[model samples]
Target chain A: MKDVSRLKSVLEKGGFAVTSECGPPKGADPQAVLRKTELLRGKVDSVNVTDNQTAIVRMSSLAACCLIKKAGLDPVLQMVVRDRNRIALQSDILGASAIGIRNVLCLSGDHQSFGNQPDAVGVFDLDSIQFVQAVRNMRDQGIIVGGEPLSHPPDMFTGAAANPFADPMDFRVVRLAKKINAGADFIQTQCIYNMERFDRWLGIARDRGLTEKAYILGGVTPLKSAGMARYMKTRVSGMDVPDQLIRRMEGVSKDKQREEGISICVETIERLKQTPGIRGVHIMAIEWEEAVGEIAERAGLLPRPVIDDQ
Target chain B: MITAQQKPIDEIRGMLVPYKRILVLGCASCVAECAAGGQKETAMLASTLRMKAKMNNEDVIIQEHTLDRQCVKDFVVTLDDIIGSYDAVLSLGCGAGVQAVAEMFSEIPVIPGLNTEFIGETRAQGLWVENCLGCGDCMLYYFGGVCPLARCSKQLFNGPCGGSVGGKCEINPDVDCAWQKIIDRLSRFGALDRLETIYPPKNWSRKQGGGPRKIIREDQQR
Candidate 1:
């Protein structure tokens, strides 16, 4: 778990571990991803390459992660258990791990109906908890997806998503415990705006004895504008925005909301740093990345620490 | 057979918007069986788009084609030569087939005209309903062939909730109660007493993610 400790200390020394998302275009335009890396090159810790995000279909996540790596950036290749079964999932684990992608995030993913193509047949074969186990199984058991012995084992830090605001918050902690029991080394959460409620979730996680077992990263996304804020608040499922944050957005002019959003994000990071037991924050700026450096600086997450090579 | 259903249109012109050149692709595998969007739906969309284009005093090209199977690569390869001619492709197959087309031609911009609903089988003529969420585990034997996991609406692991009234789901009167069906089937088979034992919650892991769920014969493995 020293890798986990080193990953944490790197972020703790400076600011949060900011991760941006890259949605590859449907057409054969690798530039959609390459351009982003050029902009975020050396600016962030790692970029998450999505897997057919809305399930409308696009370039493969494995391919995009490879491109991100080629562009001199660390990529957390994301895998969704929705379209793939356990067999395909374990195969994909070998596929990604063999490619030298060490960081992987497991997501249950939005249902097919929520994607661009509704009416899409879903392949649930495995959900979130099961996904973490598959990753862990590959490393420890040394068994391939086909139950064959692998010549070389994969070194993957298995991680899964946690939604603190899911209907019953306590159930999420139970799910987290299940993740730890299932062999999840790290946990990245859904976007958090309601800090007070999220802190309560941390207390619940502590009570469940998940503090020492897994690395927990709070999910934070910077709302670039008032429209984006409102869309996330109302449209995005399983998301809730505090009234004060809403009021703060309402007070700002349309043009300044972007800056106000950065400020709000800074405020969130500062508040998050004070909270005990939280390992780090996974900043999802959505499409906004240039503002990330400024927010980190404003939050006093400065003076990058020396790199700890894996 | 892949059961697919189509929503009938007063007319089909509403679907082809802003695109003058349209390609209508249908699947004979699933959608074709249900008569939802199969070949019939493809033709309907094609003619409807042509009529709509004519009324607007603009020229529109609708090239209609249906493959033997949409899910298979060999069948999809049928469009390999002619795909470059079309501006956009409208698929009447499930979402999987449409994505395959999109993957086949990254630039063609295929659009879906039919909504690929649940993985259902037609009980009789023109009736297809969802039977399972494919939770990766099957406890069908314990429930006398009735799945409380899928049909119960609440996905209850136990028997029917108090909500199952008159052998119908509380949410909808028309929908038959999953547990009730189970109880009836079990009683008929003298397996009804099995319901008394409390069933454990599902372990979704065995269901899929430990690895890709596979059904293969080493004998069949090439």
Candidate 2:
């Protein structure tokens, strides 16, 4: 099969790939997306545009990815089942492929209650695993959800999100296996503040041979301050922030907290590099896009690998 | 059984303001079991309304009545003769019962005093948890008898979303993650393999998504 994603090519070539995120603005401003993409340009492999992440309405991910592509960056269009039904999802995948966006990430979006639009009705027409299956079918078999053949099948790489820190911890790897079985080309995990749980989860995956089936990219989010660390621990559901990290952030002087955060992020990246099965790292600076360039450079992930556009 | 909660006292009182005479009607079936509408509740609500009217210096006649099943025409017909005596009826019944009463007496308005909740079971004393959505399709056998359509926050068929923590849903810590319950139950029975196959997107067309539904039994009908 011809490779459609540069990230996939990098990973297949056994290079340590680095990807980052760029959240579209709440309002209709192309410049907002351009500014974020520029900061991440050449600093990462591909940029993922979130689809109303945290349930807050923003510029559509499809539109934002287009902006990112135009800004000379490879874009990964993130699609969440929370907003669109199966028909719309398949349609958007076709559209994303047509618009030169080659990589896509399937996600079961954050619940609407956490977003500004709490009253909005969530449309979970397909779970993330089912979505991965749908994307793979559309790309590989030229089939849509209902098995209808497309005149031209979409050529793209598919990815799915997994959270090792979420509850029922024992079943987390089983869920990852299911995603891989459903045809996930790659897996972007939830942020890894709890290194012990992440390492244990990856070990189980390696034992089960899940690591061989899909490329696993460890997720990292740099905390800017002790307050940010505490908020992630207490307010963010499914996020595991050890008390030691929080105290480490607090251990720094107020003015130097950012530098401490970058150091911690770099340390985490260094640890992920040695982990047996990890293929890459996904840096999600969450609104602080400027921090991603620094984190990638300081962690020695700069000067991204180049591959032929297959 | 269908469950409900009584509407606020102030809202009920406001609706009764236009009427000089009102009958507080209750259903003795599902609503009665849930303690939202019943003979005892009807009397209590009638008394409260009468007291509120007296305190407001309003001349209002409040009467109370309970039927075997407000949703059945057999029980609804008994109110025919005296239906014209009241300006309106405050039906302390589930949504179906309220509509049935309204349909029976088209001349008089039937205002619902209870908000119909969901089809649920009495889990414990003073606790009713919703267990069925009546989606018109049942897949309980595959899930160890747990209905993911009703209990799962996201109605996920493949498995739990990333929001399951400590066996509770991330949306609310008090709510047990339905998939967690399913996995535990299936694991105990050695049926965890059933979840390996991905269930397709639900045919919600068979549900309210299909619009108002109806069932006609020709064998039992005259």
Candidate number of the best DockQ: 2
Write candidate 1's Cα lDDT for A1-310 as tens digits: 1232234345545434555567666767898879767766555566777788756687888889888876666778788766876778887778877777777888766556656777676765555665676677678998744456777777776776777775434345656677677777777787889988898989988876786688777778877777777887766656777767878887989888888888888888888777766766777776665666776678776543446663
- lDDT string, candidate 2, A1-310, tens digits: 3335778789889998899999999999899999999999899999999999999999999999998887778889999998899999999999888888899999999888888999988888888889999999999999988789999988778999999998778888888999999999999999999899999999999999999999999999998999999998987778999999999999999999989988999899999999999999999998899999899989999789877764
Given the true complex, what DockQ would model 2 score? 0.68
CAPRI level of candidate 2: medium
Which candidate comes out best when scored by lDDT? 2
Candidate 1: tens digits of C-alpha lDDT, residues B32-150: 87786677767876787677677878777888999878777878888988887878888887887888888878888777767678777788876887787566777899989887766
lDDT of 1 at B133: 58
Residue A230 of model 1 has an lDDT of 80
lDDT of 2: 0.90
TM-score of each: 0.62, 0.96
